[model samples]
Each structure stands twice: as C-alpha cells, then as structure tokens.
Target: MGSVTTTEQDLRARAEEVLSTLAGEDARLREDQWTAIEALVAQHRRALVVQRTGWGKSAVYFVATALLREQGAGPTVIVSPLLALMRNQIDAAIRAGIVAVTVNSANNDEWDAVYADIENGDVDVLLVSPERLNNPDFRDRVLPKLAASAGMLVVDEAHCVSDWGHDFRPDYRRLRTLIVELPSGIPVLATTATANDRVVTDVSEQLDLGTGEQTLVLRGSLDRESLRLAVVPLPTPARRLAWLASKLDEMPGAGIVYTLTVQAAEDVAEFLTERGFAVRSYSGKTAPDERLDAEADLLGNRVKALVATSALGMGFDKPDLGFVVHLGAPASPVAYYQQIGRAGRALERAEVVLLPGREDRDIWAYFASLAFPPEPLVRQTLGVLSDQPLSTASIETRVDLSRTRLEMLLKVLDADGAAKRVKGGWIATGVDWHYDAERHRRVAEARRTEQQAMLDYIATDECRLVFLRRQLDDPDPTPCGRCDTCTGTVWSDDVSADGEAAADERLSRPGVEVPPRKMWPSGMAELGVDVSGKIAAGELAGVGRAIGRLSDIGWGTRLRELLGSEDRPADDVPVPSDVLDAVVRVLAGWGWERRPVGVIGIGSRTRPHQLEHLARRIAEIGRLPLLGTLPPVGEKPGARENSAQRLAAVWGGLDTAALPDLSGVDGPVLLVDDVLDTGWTMTVAARAVRRAGAPEVLPLTLAVDG
Candidate 1:
C-alpha cells in the first residue's frame, strides 16, 4: 500500500476497529501486531512477523488491508498454501467487511468470476497458492497486471521460502522475482509461526523490495505454555497403535492423530473406526470434497479426531483444538513444533503426545532421496530438454526419475533458468546454467543434522519445549515446566491387554488388493517397447492380491523381515510357515472370477529361493499343478526405479522359454513374485504367461510397496 498520511494514534484506532470486527467488540490489538500494521500501512515498509500461531499474525495483515483499501490502494494479494487455510482466511476477511476470493486448483470453475471481482474492485483480498503464481496462463496474463497494481503482498507459511527449511517448496523461490517486479513502495509482509533464525534471515532476504529499504523482522519466542509434551519410545508399530487405541479416550479434547504417510493415515483411521472411534483419514490423496467434510467434522467436533499426514499441518485454524498425537516423530524437531502448534492454541491445557517408532527413520530416508538430484542427473535431464517442448510424460521417457521427483526437478530447473514451462510442456532455455552443488550439499547435510536432532529430542531428559524451541533459535529458551519431563509423564508406558490384542490382530490381518496395471507407461514406444495405450483386453491380468504392503503394520512387519531392502535383507531360505498360512488365507478369501489351475514363479535374482519356495507351497496347497519359473534373462533395474526405467529393464527380461508346455492349462495361472515395486515386472511377466496360453492370470505377491 502507498504510504498513508496518518498519525500513529489514527492508525492504531483504525486497526483496533478491524480487530474488533474479526475477533469481538472488546478485542484489542497486541502491541507487536499494531507495530507490524503501522510499518506496512503508514510507512509502506516490508516486514516479517515470526510469532506464535495464535499471536495475531493474521490481524496485522487484515488490519493493514482495511486501512490501505480505505486509502484507495489496490487489493492485497495473499499466497497461501492449503485450501483449508484459504477458506478460513476468506471467512476471517469477510468478518471485517473485506471481500476475499480464492483462485486455487479446486475452484477452476469460479476463476473467471473471481478475476472479474478483482478487476471490478469488489474484492479486497485475492488468495492464491504459490504454484498458481507460475501457471503459464496466469503468469503470462494476470501476474504482471496484479504486481503492477497490488497494495500489499503476504506470504503465509514463510519458512517454505527457504530451501533450508523443513518444508522447502521450489515454487516459493519465485517470490524473489515477483518481489523484484513489484512497483516501488509496495509493502510485503511475510508471516510464519515456525521459522527459526536461519529461515528468518532467508525469508527476510527474499522479502527485500530492493528499493533501498530494509525488511523489518519481528521474531518472537516459539514456546507454547499450554502444550504439555510427552514422548513414548514404543518398541513396535503394533504397540504404538495399541497405545493410541487405549489412550485416545483419555486425551483432552477433539484433536488430530498425525501420521507420516497416507497409508498410515488410512490404516490408523480404519483401525480406530473399527474400534468404534469417530475418526476419518485426511491426506494429500484425499478428495477435496472429502477433505472439506473432514475439516468441517473436526471443526464441529462431530469426530474425536482425524488421522492425518503433514498435509493437515500448516494454516489449519482451530483455536480450541484439545490435543495432537503424532504416531511417529517427524524428520525435524522444527517440523514437530509446527504440527503440535495446532493444539493448545486457545486452550489453557492440551496434550502433545509423540509415539516415536523405529520405522520413522526409514520414512525420513525415503523423502530424503527425493531431494535435488545429483549434478549428473540434472545434466541428463537438461540434455533431454532441448529447444522443442516436451511434456513431463515425454521427459520421463528420456530421464530416469519418478513423476513426483521429475516435477520437482523441472520446477527447480525452471527457476534456475535452464528450463521454461510453457502450455504444451517444458522447453530448454539453453542458459549457461550451473547446478548449485555446494548449496544443495549443505542442505542435504542440514537435513541429516535435523533428523538426528529429532532423534535426540526423543532421547532427551531435559525440558521438551526448550529442546524444540531452541531448534527454532528462540531467544533464551528455558524450561516450560508443563511437559512430561518437567511434570512426570501422565500416561503409563504399558498398553492395555485388550488394546494390544486388537491392534496386533489388525496388524496381523492379510490381503491388500493389487489392481492390475491397465494402461502402459506413456512414450513406451520411444523407450523401444511397442506396447502402448490400454493392455490388450484379451491379455489383461486380473485384479491381484498381496498379503501386505512393505509399509503395513501387520504382515508387512513380517514380510519385511524376509523381503526387506538393504537394511534387513533375508537369506534365500524356505518360506516361513506363518507366511504360507497368511498366503493361504489371502487366496481362500480372494473370490476370483476364475480359480487358477496352476502357479508360476517370476524368478528373482535377489531372492530366487524364496520366490520358488512360496510358489511351490501355494501350488501344493491349492491342489494345482506347478507350471514353471519365468527366469530373468536380462539385467533388471532397482525395484525403486521410476516406472519408465523399470518397464524398459523388464520388457523382455523374462525367459518365456523356461516354461514347460502351458497349452494343457486352460484356467487362470497364479503369477507369483516376492515383491512388487513399480508393478512393471509383473505386467510384462503376466503378459508372457497369457500369451503362453493361460486363460487368466491372478497375480499374487508377498509384499507391495506402499
């Protein structure tokens, strides 16, 4: 907003009016909130507010928006992350007579209307996601106009702007470009509750308007007096789940049960619901409508809790949220602090329980692997993208990266000026680009340090809040005297017998559906495979079955011991009897359209004995004939490789000639394997079996990657 000719008293009065409207008639502005408002509105200064979650960070912006618009400046532009956050912010804006509209991925149908409202000056605040800022159409058509005329800019969850932050997003790096292009004296306010000293400096640098003016940073303490932290270093996932099942009722109020992955969220929600608890799962995979319902349910206290991943972390506002229970520790203490901040916002007492499990480290490493790829991989990706535009699918054919990682790398390259995103796809800019190897290396090392700090948090015997707050560089962090360590743990270490029994039973249960791959990976022809489009209907593999996922709590725990990766690889021994029994149960429970007449093993270089043993046992138990082994005839890629690479490796890698005459078998054949990663091996192998004259194929696997 342009500098307003206003006195401090006048500005404070106006800000108080807005605050009262948003909160209540008796509501007053905190001194720090008033200071931020004055800096933005009266002096047109850029600012950063790093206060606690409920400390009126939003009030500063809302009040400034009212004053600026009242003084005839353009509407405020807010770059928020979550749809739930936007919804809540819009509602809060409306309370102060501010017309706010959001243009996110979920509301494409209403974008035109929203845009018209903005143009007509009928909207006071425009909320968008950071990704929307770089959309080809939006960036080309709308951003220039908005930057030319916006009053103020707000970056919610500002820590994400720094690559060193726990949730660094590449799209946020574009804020620098957006800021540089803004007109002089246009105020920018970046706010977050989770940033430490390093993130604060990084965000402050990004917030610099380059108008010979400095960013006014106001960082406050990161402690939450209302939160009582507790940590339970459970020995097993089953015990942790069991403890949750037992202690949930004793928890303070309606809250959240946090998980590290989508499958865990769904699994925990299902287990709790089966135990007659009112809970639903929320994750990045949940449908928007379902997320809305779940959010509404929790807001209304219609459910006891929502089992959610980090997707439900930032910007979710529920002042009276009673507690937050993390099933596993996050990779960093800073991130854990942010997630637990959701609780005790408006209450005097709320429980913050952490049930740290051994599997958390594995999950952390999986995410770590997705960090900025090595320079060689980056050079390869750049080599693939020439002057001609290639959609991400086309790029996948040439570069060996997963879809998620590929998208992230493309964004980084796009920001690095080595690639440009266009409507059709991405085009190489031919810039003399150099990968920031040093920076990324430091970031990676920082991640390891943060992960170890998290482990240390679990093992610490000192003040819990002090340990967490100190990670955020809080000034003089001291004991809160409210945590379990300071005030002895409230809950017992032992899980009730009944709760443990139910959880063990649930974890031990078998049979996860393994749907067949219908359409082949795009650009397979370019990869030298002729197969494309849907699998030939006559040759399609039927829906398959797996005893469990590698990430599952029950059979997964056991199966991992046998088929686990480098950490726990098993010797090529005979299949365990219990596992065989689980397979028997899975097969008996699977109501296939046609029962298999024979079983065939897909040979594994790593576990040939185990695969053959399981296949032979299944054939013997089912009273079916043992057909043959589909031996590997070519070099195969790692099981964790992307779909395109995996497919190319296994296209003709199987020796169909190894099989005996299958002409006599007319019914379904059980295509068995030790583990399924990308599912390409199974697809190619099953296609060969069907072509070998088997009428139908029922694929079975010991474990599937979650």
Candidate 2:
C-alpha cells in the first residue's frame, strides 16, 4: 500500500461512498461530517466534534477511516469507553467494509489475535477502551507501536477526559499522555454529545499535543426536535412506582427506563414485569452474557424496556427508540440530556419523562461523597507503596479505602507519573505529586451548581429542552414546541388506587439480610491488630436482618428522616412506634433455628436511648432477658473512614466486662442497634459479646446503608 495524495473533493466523495454503505444507499454525509473528514484525511488536523446523539458522530470516524486507509494510512485507533459501544462500532465498521477488532476487558483471549491482524494490516480500525491505555503490558508494549504507525486517533466520549464533565473517569485522563506521544502529522478526533462549554474547552486543550495549534471544534445544536420532554412529580416512591406500572404500557414504543441505582433498576423492572410488561433490569452488576442478550432484545423490540443505570449510557445506538423515562433526576442536567437524547434520534416523535423523587438529592449526595480522597489519605497510600510492587489487593490491605476508590486513586496517580502499575502490582514512582486542592474544590462546587440546575429543571415551567440546552451553554437556545410546558400538554400524575396500594405493600414488607464480614481487612497487623484471614466462625455474627436499606425506595425515606441531620436534637430520640413494630414483625418472620434467649444492645454514642429501647422491646416481646449494653472503651473514628481505619478506631473500643452475667444464657443472643452503616460496629460488638460467653449473636438493625 502506498500513500496517495487526494484533493478535498476526492476525500469527501470517498467519505460519502462509505457513509452510503454504512447507513444506507441513500445516506449522505452531513456538512459538518464532511468537514471533519476533510480535516482528518485531506488536511491532517485535529478536530473535536460536539454533536447530538445519532448526529452521525460514529459515521464521521468510520467514513474518515475508509478514506484514510484508502490512501495507505495506518488503521484508525479508537479509544472507546464501554464494551457495548465497542461492539456497536465494530459492527458499524464492518458494514462499511472496514475490518475492525476490539481489545477490551471482556476479550482478553482475542487480544493476541487482534494484535496479529493489526500488525499484518488486515484491520482497518482497532477499538480500545480508555482503561486499556494504562494497562501495564499494553502501555509498555503495544501502545508505542500503535501510536507511531496510527493513521488517525479517535477519542469517543471525550467529555469523560475532563473532570468537569458529568461522568468524569480517571482512566480517560491517561489519553493526554497518549495524545502527546502520538506521531506528528496524524489527525486526531475527539467526539462526545454531552460536553458543555467547560468540558469542550477542557477536552480540546488536552487534545492540543503542545503543538501551538488550536483544535478545530465543530459543535452543533443540542436540541432534539423529535423529543417531547415532560416532568411528572409524584409525591412519594410508591406513587412514582405505581404511576410507572400504569403508564409504561401507554408509552409509544420499546425504549429504556433509566434509574439512578442498581436496586432501583431491579425494583422497577421486577414491578413492571409482574404487571405484565416485558422489561429487564440492566446494570453494572448484570452478567456480560445477559447484558448482550438484553441489548439484543431491546434492539429487536422483544422487550418493552430496559430499566438501567448509567452503565447503559453511551455507545448504545437504537434508532427507533420511542421513549425514555427517568425514575429519578440525574445530578446534572447535561447528563440527563445525554440520557434523554437516546430517544427519538431517528424517529418523528419520542416521549421523554422524568419522575422526580424527594430522595433524589440524598442519593446525589451519597454519590458526591465518593469524590477524590483528601491529601492525607493520598499521602498515606503513597507512603505504603514501596520499591517492591504490591498488588491492588495487597495495597488495599494497608490503605483504608474501598476497592473502587483505591483503584481510581491508583489510576490517577499512575497518569500523573507518581505511580506505575506493573505485572506484579503497583509501585510508587517517587515523583513529587501535589494535590490540586483548588482544582478539586472548584470541581466539587461545579457539581453542586449542576445539581441545583437539575432541581431547577424539574421545577421550571419554561421549555424543558430550552432549560437543558441552556445548562449545556448551547449557542442558540430556543423552546422546543413539542415539550409538555411549551405545548401545554401535561402528562397525568394519576396512579390508580389499586396500583398505589400494591406498590405500598411492596415497599412496606421489609427485611434485608445483613451478611457478616467473614475476614478481617488485610494489613491489620501493621496497625498493631492481631486479626487476619478468615474470622473464627464461633466469633462471627450470624447472618442478620435489617428493616430496610438506607437507599431503598421503601423504608429508606423513613430511615433517612430518622437518621438525617434535619434535627440533631432528635438523633438520640427514642425509636418511633412504627419502627418498633417493624422490628417485632422482622423478629416474628425471622427464620432462626434457635430463638435468641437474651437481647443485648450495642452502645451508641449518638443514639443510646434508641438502642436501649429497641433491645428492651425485643426482649419483652420474645420473653428474653435484656442484657446490658457494651461499654465504650475509647473514642470511635468518624463514620466515613475506610474499613481498616474504622476497625483500628474501634478495635479496643468495646468493653465486654459491662455485660451482665451471660453464663446463665447458653443460647444465641440478639444484638440490637438503631442503624448499621459499615457493619464494623456490629462485628466488633458481636465479637465482644461472644467472647463474653454468649454462645452466638444474632444482629438486627432498623436500617442498613446499601
């Protein structure tokens, strides 16, 4: 193959030919699409495309690849974000006579074969995920070769590279390094539909490669003409669920029902399916095979809807999707628009509705709490990393962070050159890394602003599309005449009485299993704790029960009201009558082989009275003795600390000597608490009681944080 010089007209014609093949015989390139292709194939310049979904973003890259490969350029290397996106792009590429192969977490076995194809010039395009950019082997071995010989580089979902983006991914930040290392004169394209002005600027700056050249940014209208946006504010979770159960069938066609969490998605899907609707729950927890099957089902219109989270956000291309309904408001209007954009892309009309809940802000706050850790934690993590490589599991033992947060931090550190992930594990690079406190603070403030914007969107009477477009800083914001507000066509908020009763019944029946921690967190020995490996079964608390999760739609609202900080003076208030009754119901329904002979309360610093009342009531109802509460030995750490740190703070904090004579009770003891968040408190308290001669401990709580 030889490099062939082609005029702008020739490149456009070739791009149009590929577009016709990929889309259809009558398909033609949009003006912006041709401009992007011309910049890539004819002028060899960088471009950033911020176009609406179904605006042929993928087509731009596919067409450009066809034209570039015709002139003997290397295969187009696309860094996609999700497996579903990769799969869709590969199929689309093949339709245009482009041989595309993907290397993602799901296809480890095919990597070598894919590499062979790329090396032999049998592949016109190669799709890799952002996370792949930092893989030890891929980064050290494959990336350099691919970067040097790449005809063009593409970053899909490029907004993710900007921390200000609604869905900021640390893995995507590593693309900056890749762009810097790429050979000069090769065209690069960064594309996304959800980036606002800030995200576009951030992503464009990152794509510059220090060339002293401005990126060619092509941004189109954010408005979706075919969407009919509306908000249906239901007063309660039960009402919302009931409304969905009744109104879902009336929606136009097969589409997606978005939820804010996995549990919500599953609950909605189950409720709808029980009501005779064909819907399936799709989340990150969904099995890979099941996800593929679900996507196929929706595409084939075999299922009415897929109740999903952001896991199904980008890369899904369903042209005729008739509706999109959000069960809860997203934290950002930009993100909401991106999700609602999934509908009516190629159709004349699609229904988009948002059912805002009172609990949406609480959910948003919980997720917002997972932002980058403080500097002290980051320093502690780096201090624990030695010259010797430590696996993530091993590092996790020393760092008091959740596995997800730990991995994210490690990725950011690696991208900043402060650490390296190798085959053995991760190693500190000894580079001086400074925490960008101001930047992080700004980002957090931006999140709060976006959240407020989302709230405003739900309350506004103006055009919903116009509000969302304004939030994204669209150059020409205008009212979409099809929206509920614009057309004065409000969706009914009426839920049948029977439907509401059924939903209430589902929410009222509560008892979530609380599984005990089987193993002590690793690296406890370094903290002067003697615990490690599997916990002794005799000392472990049996599978316990909670009235509900703090995040559940059912009892979650009540629990939040009880535990929320609206009234600090009420924190120690006695357990409510309804909660106490629910506790009794949970006990009556408990399937324990040996009923508790005594009830013991875990000492609570903030709500001791609540705990005592709970224990006394349970003992009185079950005809058991009310054992005394465990004595506090020391101050416990804040509730937000990691598991290891939490354990360390509470290791010797429980005094077993305070327990009443347990020798007379040679049976399972019931452990009562006001609430369970980390389970560490329960674990430590149960161990102390068991060691104090209780044969077994059965833990129960009013609420558990999911």
Location of the lowest summed lDDT over 10 successive residues in candidate 2: 563-572
Off by over 4 Å in 1: 1-6, 566-569, 638-640
Predicted candidate 1 versus true structure: per-residue lDDT over 1-706, tens digit per residue: 5664558778788789888999999999887888799899989999999998888888889999999999999999999988899999999999998989999898899988988888888889999999998899888888998999899999999998899888999888778889988999899999998988888888888787476777999888787879999898788888999999988999977999999988889989999999999999999999999999999999999999999999998889999999999998899998999999999888999999999887788789878878888889889999998778899988888888888888989987887678989999999998989878899899999999999999999999999999998899986657899988898865787988888888988888888899999988889889899988889977888899999888775666677778768666789998989999999999999998778889999998888888888999999999988899999986755544578778988888899888777767878899999888889889999888888888888899989987
lDDT of each: 0.88, 0.88
What's the true lDDT of residue 405 in model 2?
88
By summed lDDT, the worst window of 10 consecutive residues in model 1 runs over 634-643
Error of 2 at 534 (Å): 1.4
Indicate the residue-level lDDT of 460 in model 2. 94
For model 1 the local lDDT of residue 291 reads: 94
As a whole number from 0 to 100, the lDDT of residue 333 in candidate 1 is 92
